[model samples]
Target: MPSHVAPTTAEVYRAHLADASTSSDVFAAGLAEEPAAALVNALAGLDDPPTVRLLVTETVAKWLRRDFHLASTAADLLAAETLSLRVADGSFANQMVVTADAVASILSTDEQTAGPATDDPEFVDSMRERCSEAWETAEPFDLRTPPRSRVYETLGDEIDPAVEADYQAMLDAVETTRSNGYRTTDDDRFDEVELVLLAGAKHELQHYDLSRWGEDVGLASKATFSRTKNRLEDQGLLTTEKVPIDIGRPRQRLVLDDRLRDVEAGDLPEAGRDVIDSATE
Candidate 1:
């Protein structure tokens, strides 16, 4: 149970489930009585269960690409469904707004960085309504053939400018090295490392554990991502720390240094001093 004022997307998803008890307990608890709860359980396999909203969002994405074969339609449906969820009494609605803002933020990363952290609330609120109709039902709603490119054209759009600036600094540091050129065999690895950092930064902001992050980032293996993460730590960009709160295996957690965390929190100006002080402390 999260505090009701604009629960994070993660919290919204979590509140859907019945407790830690077994399925028997869930059935006995009568979660079947609620349509929204039942819909969530039927889709997610647990009554009153917690789920990542991204799961729902991406499910709509996949269905758009594959089943309905209409990428635009799928996006539309998901956007719509998520919107309706927001207006409902459940916390899912608020989470939907957060997810929409995140998507918009990622889409608009190249803009000026010094806003009041409180972005367009009305626009974000509108995304809920606008998006809900877009992804209203998961039924075969494909609209067009998805482009099969692994290197998405939109990748650059998703990169955080702060992360990009930090990586560019790293690139500048290694520019004279024979192995640092984009044409070199290691360049792809470098790109992957930056991507992992970006993904990791988002994870830190969203508070997704590493395993969940791996799933969200669509990595082939959590271990491989960990290896890249360690390489980043070696480069002094991330911290290879463990946390007991991580539901994943021991040594699987990665903590972004305070500097990066500040950037994610829209506190980048303070981030410079904070990062140094925290790292040294």
Candidate 2:
């Protein structure tokens, strides 16, 4: 028989959340601030589109129910910690504490291996009580909006059908980029919003007015998108043209520059890095 292969830490946690039979109230402890952040980034950056949406949506729903919590020794990390909690539901339904090493496994990009886990009732109860006490003294923090769900809720109500279709198309393009192995959190230069703009510019094969695209994505403010777009242009990766409109000032239509014109939708991340690298040299 083939040697037993362990499910990845991500796979383990995702399964726990998907199992309705598991306990709803979940607690995680022992993850350091850095690894905790990486875990969230990895979940958000998963290659499968449906899995990405499912994990984000499930984790956020649990968090909203007050059924999920993370404890850390670093009080200053709470704000960022809460964001990670929004991304991960729990490792095991019964276990309240996870080792830092296990978290590192979750963040690993290599062949995913299972981390240590347990379902012992007494052990879980003890850990849960300990974590609850710790949480009482922990600094207060509020959960941020779940990144993936916020996209849908933000764009759910477009009055113009054509505009709504375009928004969906751009979002699809972004997913395509993800499938192509571009991770927003992994890339220091371009964030999720920036990737959306670049991928949209390339794959959509049409120009979107900057403000409108930002409003539709709902991930960042229009002003943020404007700033990011300007930065990308400065780096020679993007260009914009003014389009005549029926009202107000001419709209700026986002376009990928010559460097990115030939890049396939899936090859964006690599191509983007090359352009950004060449510009700085």
Question: Candidate 2, residues 126-179: lDDT per residue as tens digits?
Answer: 665655565444443344323444343343443233334444444444322211
Backbone atom clashes (below 3 Å) for every candidate: 28, 0
TM-score of 2: 0.54
lDDT for 127 (candidate 2) = 61
Local error of candidate 2 at residue 4 (angstroms): 12
Best by TM-score: 2
Error of 1 at 25 (Å): 55
Task: TM-score for candidate 1, please give it.
Answer: 0.26
TM-score of each: 0.26, 0.54
Best by lDDT: 2
lDDT of 1 by residue, 1-281 (tens): 12222223223333322322222111111111122232332324333332223313333333323321123222333443421222211223322213323212111123211111223658645654544543343233232322212113222335344434443344333312121212221232243334445444534422234434344434324565555565556544556544455466544345665456545333322343344345556
lDDT of 2: 0.44
Model 2 segments more than 4 A misplaced: 1-8, 11-21, 33-123, 136-140, 143-146, 149-188, 203-210, 213-217
